[model samples]
Target: MTFRQKNKITVLGHDIKAGENCELSFGVANLHTSSSVDVPVIIERSKKPGPVVLFTAGIHGDEVNGVEIIRQIIAKGINKPKAGTIICIPIINVFGFINLNREFPDGRDLNRVFPGTKNGSLASRVAYKLVNEVIPDVDFIMDFHTGGAGRFNAPQIRIAKNNPKLDKLADVFGSPFVLYSKNIKKSFRNTCHKLDIPILLFEGGKSFHIDDQVTNTAVNGAKRVLNHLGMLSTRFKISKPKKMPVYILDSRWQRASFSGMFKPSIAINSKVTKGDVIGNITDPYGKFNHFVKASNSGYIINVNESPIVYQGDALFHITTKLK
Candidate 1:
């Protein structure tokens, strides 16, 4: 929660002093066509020295909703802080983004390769550059993400359990839900945690889709966090969340009982009771219809939006315990 007062900071080998704004290129590799791909890193610093907060999204190329959140943050000038430095990397997996795919061109999941080696795979090289060149000077990070594979996640802030500092920060972010999640091995969140850099992983909406409600929720949360840190500009107004976030201690996915056309009757963030019919599965031939009942009484944090689902596929993510 504390940051050393820095007069000058270097990012991507470029030195930027206080009260300066810079846009640096994080070009990792070229496309198969040999075209250049440069990831833009937008930065803004204040005259006063304070914390350096990094806002990142598009770790998975298909998670366009996350990219949109960062896009709005920059387009609305929200990245211009009143104190400290605000760094925005709206898209990270440019290769996947370019191909409209989730993984890098070489089929490696970028999130799985962290603290990478210099002479590794394409995804690993990007991860290496990010962990080595960028993360060293970061005080905190807010990594945006969206649900994958036709699943829609409710807007939520995810963090490891039992960190008071992260808990307070998550409260300040004020999303609809705060789900306690463990960091994945070799993931960006895990690397940051190992480096002692606190981070909040935000998951919302669905891949390749953008919802206004989800975007607004994340943007507002970011603004609130900036305000809490005394980095928000006076020109921006912060709105309080309608209700306090639900702290989810444990959750489970309710899988589909039958494979067929699927439709969710309950929406994300909706609370349900045990045995409630939250969704249904039906065959295309109208021979059978199966009502998907809730496994237990809890909030629906994620819903599978895919029309056709298979048996044992995750249909709904329901909370099991609350803090």
Candidate 2:
């Protein structure tokens, strides 16, 4: 297959070529009197054609792990895909990322605004454009993500639908855990699936920080997915990921119950038994303390990092049983 130079497609003011890979900044808007915003996309093309895979991150903005993972992959270089193209969008919500926030300037969760309207809110327009222009060009997508700020998550792949093909892809990701979930109402992955595009969501570590272990797992898992798709050669193989017992947990927020300083006993991935004291929430006066207990036996998949808490603030996210 010979590579030819195709004409350029301009997004906002940046150029993306059809045959060759390029980076382009799309859309421009003002949130305030002085500043404007633009989304960055890196499109890489193989000399030979193959399945085009889109690697996107920062949809929730504060999820730094996914952003970094995408950055590292492009910087390192991907092997030639056997058929199409590869599009990598490291940070889709620049406004939220800059503020270290999970939502947009309007306080809307960008992840929920999928297949958005062209003339709607800033987030909606971005989603609409992404679904219309970018995603339609890909055969598959692998979206990267992490827990929001003040929360932690185990490195895992989320299979939202029951496609055996996708399940096999998730297994090939080689993570210690794979979360079987159904498509959430309006998530980007769900929207893509509606378009007959198979998209896998890879969640690892926590928001706003980078963990080398989690990053490595994400990269290796994505590489395996590419290999499984025949986008890349299968010369490099990874051991089957350890199977952690799968749980369809009825997860709920364990709030502080009162405004106080939280002293947490468990960290992410800590196993706890039912009735175990997970943390202590104390008032300013050394006088009163309330114990935070586990209602069920499970591993602490997410824990609050901040000590200062308000009533109704989420403290822990547990996934019961380990495989």
Candidate 3:
């Protein structure tokens, strides 16, 4: 976990020296109306030398909870480090963010396109610029994210298993749960891994929604990591996690048995026994009501909040095994 000290770092073609604070534009394209889009890249550096950390969010655009966590970090002056450089990109997909959609105008998931071609689609080109320009000097990254659609994910950190470096960092992040997941092909996490940059992928709450508790947990985790790296400013106080995180090794989705209105009786992060009633699916006329039972005794990490569901829609994400 030791980082080589950097006195001068170049980001997006800007040569930033020690103790310099700069805000640069990450603009790639303009809107249909020809208006320019500004993606601000905020960089804060300390006179003392330490590791360079990057905080990024809004890869999906609709994941406002992640955006909020970074926003609070910037607003509270958390990005001003004590002995290193901190970079913050609060929103990455400005196109999707402007349209209030999850994908780009070209219908591409920004997260799926990594190390893209210079002349490829809009998403691909942006990915290429990020990989080639901003990421070359970053030592570590913390990309914030949230569950898709109506699924609410409990506060958690996701990392590829068996990497002791990632395992120790995930523990330092101190989220309530740590899930081991494989890196998807061409994903941002995979790209960072290929470049040998350590990253911690955080998931919590739901897209387009922000919970105070979730925000607090993520913010505190960021503080703890910065403190660990000797980069956090002395003005901030680090709070120990109330409890140790649950490490999930395997998990399964509990799908709906019948198509109808759905309500979850069990909350997220709740541990349940096998055959316990966790939710119920019923028709609008009340003619039939089927109670959903837990398939195994484990924790409920994600709960789908959609009112209407199909017969096979994922209703709950329950842990099948733990470490």
Candidate 4:
């Protein structure tokens, strides 16, 4: 794979200077329609060398807020890193990003296909490219995401519980809450951790739409990481790192029993008690109303926002309640 070196104008130390950022091609593929596609990376290498931290978004493609956040960071003339490199892949699943869809054109979830195979499915091939050409080079990795279509997730961090370093990194972002997650099946975080590479998951916003608050929060967090890694000289007054954030070892999705308009009584991040009325499923024809209640007491980490739902569709994602 060949890479081209380009000098990009960066605002560092209150002045604009041209710096080298890498444009490396990951892998190429031929679409069934006879067109070719290439996955490339944008790496900002500082004049002084320090730890390399990779910040990626669009792992799910539909997660737009993170993508916007990355874009803003690269474009905004704010504090610049003094040492090491910052690789920003604002759009990972390019095909999905183009189509404004969550899954790849091959109908696979890119997040669940990690450390992929050289010769495998589309998702696997891309995952392999990331793990080999990208992951191995970074000292730390931050993957950004947002709630999928039909759901809303508050700005939060998700870190693997075993890595104290990664856990500390999560709190530096100053989000309202953090979740201690385990190695999910075939997840990118799982693959990165297996290689002892610390990774943090920051999820916010909603798919196909940009939320200003989430974007700002993510931009601030990325800058803080740059500061934390010594890539930048400016001091970010990160709020004191929070105690190990509450953990949700397990979560379950509550699905709708019947299709109708969903009037949610609870908001994302709200705490609910067992049997609390969370929402009401009602008919637009004004004949039927079904109440939805919490089966267990916990934090409402996620809620459906699609307004309408189908039978058996997931409606709520409840994290274990904090005592």
Pairs of residues clashing in candidate 4: 50-84
TM-score winner, 3 or 4: 3
Q: Write candidate 3's Cα lDDT for 75-109 as tens digits.
A: 99999999899999999998988776899999999
Total clashes, candidate 3?
0
lDDT of 2 by residue, 42-139 (tens): 77665555666789998988899999999877776753344356778888888888888889987888889887899998889888888877765567
Better of 3 and 4 by lDDT: 3
TM-score of each: 0.99, 0.83, 0.99, 0.84
C-alpha-based local distance difference test score of model 3: 0.95
Estimate the overall C-alpha local distance difference test score of candidate 4.
Answer: 0.75
Model 4: per-residue Cα lDDT over 1-323, one tens digit each:
11123233222112212356656655446667877666656666677656667788888878888888888877773334677667778888888887888988889998898888989989898888788766655677888999886688877888766666766777666676677667798999889888878788998878988988778777777776676666665554443433434555666788898999998888887878889999999999999999999988888888888888989988998875441
Model 1 alpha-carbon drift over 4 Å, by segment: none
Q: Give the local distance difference test score of model 2.
A: 0.75
CA RMSD per model (angstroms): 0.7, 4.3, 0.6, 6.0
Total backbone clashes of model 2? Answer: 9
Model 3 misplaced regions, further than 4 Å: none
